[model samples]
Target: MSGDPVAGVTAKTFGQLPDGREVELYLLVNANGLEMTVMSYGGTIVSLKVPDAQGNAEDVVLGFDSLEDYLSPAYRSANPYFGAIIGRYGNRIAGGQFEIDGTAYQVPTNDGENSLHGGDRGFDQRLWQVSAVDAKDGVGVVLSLVSEDGDQGYPGQLETQVRYTLTNDNALDIRYQATTNETTPINLTQHSYFNLEGEGGVEGQSGILDHILTLNAEAFTPVDEGLIPTGEIRSVEGTAFDFREPTPVGSRIDGDDQQLQRGKGYDHNFVLADNASDAKNGSDAEGLVLAARVEAPQSGRIMEVYTTEPGVQFYSGNFLDGSLVGKAGQPYEHRSGLALETQHFPDSPNQPDFPSTLLSAGETYKSHTRYEFSTR
Candidate 1:
């Protein structure tokens, strides 16, 4: 066992809701002294402490200091999605409507005319039930929630469980599982804006645009002015979206590209390379392919994303306009942190060519994404 003061799983009362429900924070530490703090509210990752090349550890995830800040009036509107679980549907559903089993449904539209990240009140804003688990490789926590049939204009009573395991090898493993009593579409993803330079970067010390990024994707889904996918899997070749090679995030971020103008930055989904490539090499494990690899040059901090999801959304914190201050008591500015959300493609239900996100009553939906941290 680790000799750290916050080793294993420790729970503390974080805050209380308007209805008298108490929110809790679970702290998990590994033998290497890497710490992970998660809150019951939204199953949010409050902080993630990772080490630099010189063994200096710092919190690398962007988040608020207290539950009150997360519950403030501008929390949902002004703040970019940070360190929370996005769900029901992770991305946009065109027109906020879709047909499932010949029945048309309309969810709440929060992003213009499209339904974004579930709705006005997503799983990210909910209070989940938390429990500590003693797993085979490491200690972790499990957060579970139940969404009613008509809760978010979805036709199902869905039960979800998200397990966050911090392994001794410096990996934060996020596993998600869901079961529904009725037919519905389900896509859950973690929305943690990462700045490898640590919380200091989030405090406006530096921008994440200098981080080196590489995505194992040859194609990406293009979007319209409303930021909804245009039902096309366009090639990234000869385009700024190309990240098959390690490239500085700011190299072409300000180019005069229509897609870039639509998202205001990197806010599109990259379709991951097929698992068959790794399967042929006899290295495919649980179909977890390398989604993205990021490195902070100055800090020598690296984060590799491996997941079973088909696509990864690269959001460059375009909306953070220095209005809201973070835990480090500094305003989170634009391009301060980046989010690589691994999930099924956006508007999959509306796009027949895309992979399906449907989960029936008799079937179980399972997905896992691992964030492996190291100094390179």
Candidate 2:
């Protein structure tokens, strides 16, 4: 919280949504003159303000005003992933069915006909408890929540905690920790669409198509039309999936590709780079490590992701058809949104070969992902 003062800027308990639910919003200000507002509702990030070359700040993440914006489907509230804490299960499940311990269980479908992000009622849509706020640590906020047994067809009374720190180095560090009383699968990540150019991400968007993206990966998991992984790790060398070089996102977007047609764009999961060369860092480096980078040429804004997970899903907003009006009345057209989700591969629970996302009792589930921002 910066005391420097801006008109209409103050930190206080802004309460009660349309559902009569009480929520707490924590406003965090970083050292480099950046600011953000996070709320306990879905543990969501309401606003993220970062400065441009001219030192003018702009809100780069998409969000809605009043509770109406959230309740409306147009606001993508059902997704609950608009800067919220995703968990228990982060991706989809085939027909909402999977087998564990030789027993198969069915989950309800939330996205079209597939079970997306936890389920119809996932962590994203619920209000989380604001457990702690440590201003001394440069505005670190802790949020906690408990998932009742059988919630979303997942078994167990799961306890989860998320810590977000807006650091002095112009970075936002997000940490996730969880424990389950029964044998259940869990995967959590943050969904924040960033437009360094601010407002509309394309056209006048600060980042150019030439923005360099380096994914330390040799292969990526292919997907079906519904956007579920097909359990195949195909080489990226000769495909649009290849980012070994700093190629523009649109360079290979027009190529004839079935996966592209299924997703309407790039939505596949890339296998993470293995850091086994450093065995010591291998275990604790359990999450995705330095998985990918998205750089903006004009603003010199660079986003480097570090996680303990094994895959990073790069989605090019294929479904955003300009039907939704974004901030400043800009239409959120196709490819305007990008979600770099770091986690275990999608449908991990169902796929035996994929990394195990299950957390047995007594096994602590922990993952840390940092989206550090800096200039070139």
Best candidate according to TM-score? 1
- Model 1 TM-score is 0.95
lDDT of 1 at 181: 90
What C-alpha root-mean-square deviation, in Å, does candidate 2 show against the real structure?
A: 3.4
lDDT string, candidate 1, 305-356, tens digits: 9998888999998998888888887678888899999988889889877887
- Name the lDDT of candidate 1: 0.88
**Clash pairs of candidate 2?**
197-206, 286-308, 287-307, 287-308, 287-309, 288-307, 288-308, 288-309
**lDDT per residue, candidate 2, 195-256, as tens digits?**
66664665654222445677877888898888888888789988889986676666776678
- Residue 29 of candidate 2: its Cα lDDT? 71
